[model samples]
Target: MYLVKIIKLALVSGAIFIGVHAFAQDDNNKAVVMGNFQLDGQYYLEDSAISAVVPEETMALSGFGNILYRKGKFTAGMRFETYLPAPVGYPAGASWSGTGIGYRFAQYSDDLFDITVGNFYEQFGNGMIMRTWEDRGLGVDYMLDGVRLKVRPSDWSEITAIYGKQRFNFDNGTQFVSDDLGQGIVRGINADFDLNSLLDSIVALPGQLSIGGSFVSKFQNNNSARYDFPENVGAGSARLKYNIGGFQFSGEYTWIGENPSAQNAQIVNIPDSLDPSVGLWATGKGVNLNGTYSTRGFGVSITASSLSNMAFQSQREAGAFDSWINYLPPTSVLQTYLLSQLYPYATQPNGEVAYRGDLFYNFKRNTTLGGRYGMKLELSYTQVNSPNIAELNDLGTSRNGAKIDLFDPGDEIYFSDFNAKLTKKFSKKFKGILFYQNIVYNNDVILGAYDYDNVPTKGTVYSDLFVFEGNVKINKKNNIRFEAQALFTNQHLQDWVAGLVEYTVSPHWFFTVIDQWNYGNGDGDDFHFPSVSWGYIKNSSRISVTYGRQRAGVFCVGGICRVVPASNGLSISITSSF
Candidate 1:
């Protein structure tokens, strides 16, 4: 392993040299330099009560930095990453060891065309058919390494072409392996047009119109000996957008060829054994539609979407978040409150029908409903249901694994949420917010056995959550804030209460203390989770340190998620940009 690390570092150094030497060849133009830095370190502490464990290493560090240089239309950059034996909760199978250059890229651009070589991120049409991005918070990075070209001949039309391989892991070697599945080749093209811009002289239009389409295909050599899996899978998508004055509408639909992988593979249960293999591949498709209306003091939007057998991966064997060729847009309202998010929703890519709607309003300044600073309020509702499934055989052993329309709402409900928030300013120096929510969730369909148990829980969890928060301005450079929140429930983790308080001193320092207590659990003993943090900020840099117990749960963004383990530790984070 040590030898491998040395080789990777040497190769990375050579690449950097080559890139710099090439840039130096352009002596006429002055180069602009830029850089960024971030670091995070964790010291583990044991708390058996929360199932938190301390590994033998006792400590871990994970950090990265980026350096770049630009001269005219040409530019190049490299990102350095290090992980001294990644922390306990880091994504499994990620090789965050031995200092190495994880990402390096070079690009050149002009008014008509742009070209990039090495590693890059790309997305098409709301990311329904293809997307390659990174979310460090979730430990998800799906960058593609190869070549990309974009062309815009006129103001109304644009085209993009890319040929690359999905990055499975971090290494500068002949071979790479992902925790879920190895490497796979990907090729795609996308085109878009501004219909209004193209037809301005022919006809007058009141609103803008745009259209786009993308086709992406991936190839992975078949590794299974008994089954002839699909070596090449293709997905296509089309989208339309229109905005007229204060009203707007947009929609996207995706079609995926028959491709099955470990994540969404169809499995059947029988009287003799649990069948892990039945259907070799699944026919997949999905759709999303949304509309919004906005005026001076009010706004409203509604969205409906569905995904069925749409787990398209570069490799049929990839599981979890590895090698995802596309992303299913998040269908639920993202809850930001600490307690409100304790039971956040996770997207079901295999088969689900979901809908969400939101409304926001602000009262006039002098009206009774407005108070001193015009009052603001918002309302949101979201619901999701399982996709209608029909068994191919005349038996009840299948796991409801059948092709169905993305718009077909199944009979079984999976989850539902209704929430509202109201904000008001009692005085020039004081402000407050009140929130309420009701959520109904099916554990068996969503979280299964939440406590890491094998036996599934067969019941619905109904919870009503509430929160009251306020902020006070003491003076020019001092302020205070506090929060009180609770969730009333009779199922799953049962009932819980949480409180928080914070103080800030101008543009420099802040401190916070918070506690979440589970007063009602299956076990009689009440568990209280407490944590403290202090932060310092200056210009584009900031630093914070926290010590506390973290609950085990699944965290997600953009429909991708990872399981986080319970942990009690002292953690520090520092960030800066230049």
Candidate 2:
């Protein structure tokens, strides 16, 4: 009976495909369909050794699919999402269960203008003043739902405008329009001009030059009982970029009006006073500068930023992962090795002064230092500190926060990292990398979690890490790679070592095994974490499965972070694009 049903389904599918192809051939304007899908599910298990808990549901699943339709100059798309009692550590609240349309939009574009209505994402001026975006790995989505317009008046100039509300949470089976939107309304406009092109008719210049500016505002009803909030908050930014030869320079400055909310309440008012004008309700500002010089095999870059009370959100009461209006890029580089990420840093939005520098050099082959194969060397350093704040009291004796100096670095150091890496190619099929880093992490300031298991982390923790990685191409179809890492620290979790082995059968199959051991615990109760996984890839689809004990730690991507709970589970992931 099953075989007969399968045959019937195949025949019907073939008939439909043939009919569609003939219809397309008959019409000049044929419609095209494209989309992608992904699913992540985990089945938990009880593990006393790792303090892993199995929830009442026993399993958790999250998935989404996007379908897009396009013709000539018009396009439309929608996304379907489901959380079935979201995965552990997911930012999606309890209300995000069941299935619903997460996003939908219709857009039209031509040489003169482009317009979008429904849902969209955008960024302006390094994203310091406004950025509506999402990162699935961090479980953060701030996509705007409304209308976006872009106009190009000339080849050298363009303008963009937006009016929208940010997506907050999904209500099960509700109307897809504004049911899941935030309470505040947002509006913005931006203009960019290419100076070189604009001045070409008047004068001939060197290199390239460009300038842009943006103004964004958010509106929300004032319902606070204790403080008088601004019904409409506004922010503006200006940016400039210049490039000549192999050198590039860019900078942006953003300023926001006085906006007080729950996140900055500590510094919003004096220690015992509530008068809005007496405290740090002063205007906020952010300045970012970047410069890069690259030529041949050597290059260098520098980035510096200063921010003071610059955390802006569409709604004053929104949480950290919701309704965010701006994005502050981090100064530290992202780590690739798993163990190196244990101490990843997050950008501080309230007030911070940060700097980062990087240097890269490559040695030519047939030299004393480069050997028969070429070698590459990389060095980087990053530091972050709190901006100085003055007191608001009469005598200035009490430590009541008042005004902030953006360039002033206070005594407290939030985080810092100094790292170096060397990559060498010993042969055509052999390559190796050696990396080392020294990190200073302030748990009290960074994680805001001072204690673990009744033991305090003692404010600041210092650690040194080393990694050794090698890869070998056994043949045309097979490859193997291995990594060994060690982290030494006296505070927090203490000393640890980890190793990973991965094998790949070229084009389709791969397997990996990894383990971490904490052997320096003071209580003599050491712990070991192990995991294994296998994956297969074909065309545009891939699937993988892993079963192991996961340690409780912080996971971060692009300066944003989320806490991942300890779990012993069988996990599966599938993704496809068509």
Candidate 3:
């Protein structure tokens, strides 16, 4: 393992030195130097409600930037990151406060092939089963640290392969378990090909056809343990797409191996008896399965995915960073408004099955009703279930005489929503949209599960929201947009009303103000949350400042979620490019 690390370092260092020295001598290299940087600094005003995490009236600064040089077939780049006084809400005991070259890599590409060393991002198909990427705002990044290759032998097909270890943050450190082993390794291969091209030479077929497949495997060394654990884990997926005239269809399916992590485990209900096999046995309450199955598409998708005792991660020993091996499909509808997201569904890492469908069409551009008005609609539904479990009991006067009990499996955890919207253009500068949304959410199953303090009670929340939005043109250099919404609901909180106004000055500046008020609460205490923000954009640089009172809620992307605390203060953000 040490030798492999040495070799990798030597290769990257040599490549960087050679690439830079060679490019310096080429007069017509045509290489362009470019990249961007961003800095975020915040000063918190004293607020007792939000001061538990950070001191009152304190300030913190954190920033990151990158530099890249691209010439004809070669490219090299590096990124620098710093956290002088790491911002609030960072993970407890996190020590990522320093300035260093966090990411460095070099790449070479041409008509036939492309290669990269040090760091890169890749995805297989829809990334339902395998994806390695980054989302900065969410603090999620899992870039591979090694070598990647891409090949194109023909015009109709391409292939890619990669081998590496996942990066956590700024440094490379080993995870120390009770029985220390070596680092883990991951490798994957994928290919995309056009079926029409192949059939054009062999047979006659109409329309366009495309298909792709990918396979990924991870290796981990296991030490002595009472239970059996597989050293090698593998997953694969396949996809197909067909388009002919006005009709189009696409589908994907993925299968994963049994790789249990922290997310999937069985819960034990212990009694007064000291016997190891006695007491009530309970399966983990959340999503738990044997392996994993996922199928999704644009036309119609019916997915029955079960994750038995499977906690997919790139490094079995590393902390949660860029280590997820499988993507957890979301089983709840995503709400767009700040108030509507009060009880958001966090993905159950243990198990779930979901089905979704979407349809869209356009009317003629010049008819009495269809000419100026464009009609659009959307509908989505999801369902969730718990894992199956078997109970065991053995503590008694006769040790050999033991009893086993199995509990009945639960029903689908949740179900929701149908939404629709219509838009019309009064003229080029004036446009309006009428929107309606209906959602039936199961609060007891999702939120109750997270906030265990509350007892589990079954109830459905139904909401009807009507919104009218439009944009107006004052002149070629100025425009303004307005929105007004009313929500009617009987469960949870009372009915609410909201509004927003935005003004933009062409070429560089814009400002927006929004407010939401719970007007029909029976308790007579109506809460109000409001904010105003201004942004300046030029080329690849942007700056934004916002001051407001924010309500707390769960923020999520994909299936990952984080709870954002309520804050009342001013925030500033700056981004620039060279």
Best by the lDDT measure: 2
Summing lDDT over every window of 10 consecutive residues in candidate 2, give the lowest-scoring window.
173-182
Q: If the candidates were sorted by their lDDT against the true structure, best first, what order would they fall in?
A: 2, 1, 3
Q: Show where candidate 1 strays beyond 4 Å.
A: 1-29, 171-182, 267-276, 394-401, 452-458, 522-526
Across 416-482, the per-residue lDDT of candidate 1 in tens digits comes to: 8999999999997899999999988887777622542323346888899999999999998999999
Task: Please give the TM-score that candidate 3 achieves against the real structure.
Answer: 0.77
lDDT, model 3: 0.62
TM-scores for every predicted model = 0.90, 0.90, 0.77
- The TM-score between candidate 2 and the true structure equals 0.90
Error at 222, model 2, angstroms: 0.1
| CA-RMSD of model 2 | 6.9
* CA lDDT scores, all candidates in order: 0.80, 0.81, 0.62
Report RMSD (Å) for each prediction in the order shown: 5.8, 6.9, 7.3
**What digit string (tens of lDDT, one per residue) describes model 3 on residues 1-578?**
99999999999999988987797688777678999888877665544432223434376666778899998888999877766554554433224456677677999999898999987788888765567776655555667778999999888899999998766554322111112322456789999999888777897668788999988888777542432455677877788777665455666666657653333432112112334432221222112112112223223333334433334665544443346655664656675754456555656554444444434344446766666654433444444444343334345432221121112234644545556666677787888877777766676545521111123334766777788889999899899999888888887555878888999999899999988776775543435668899999998889999887565456666666655555566778899999
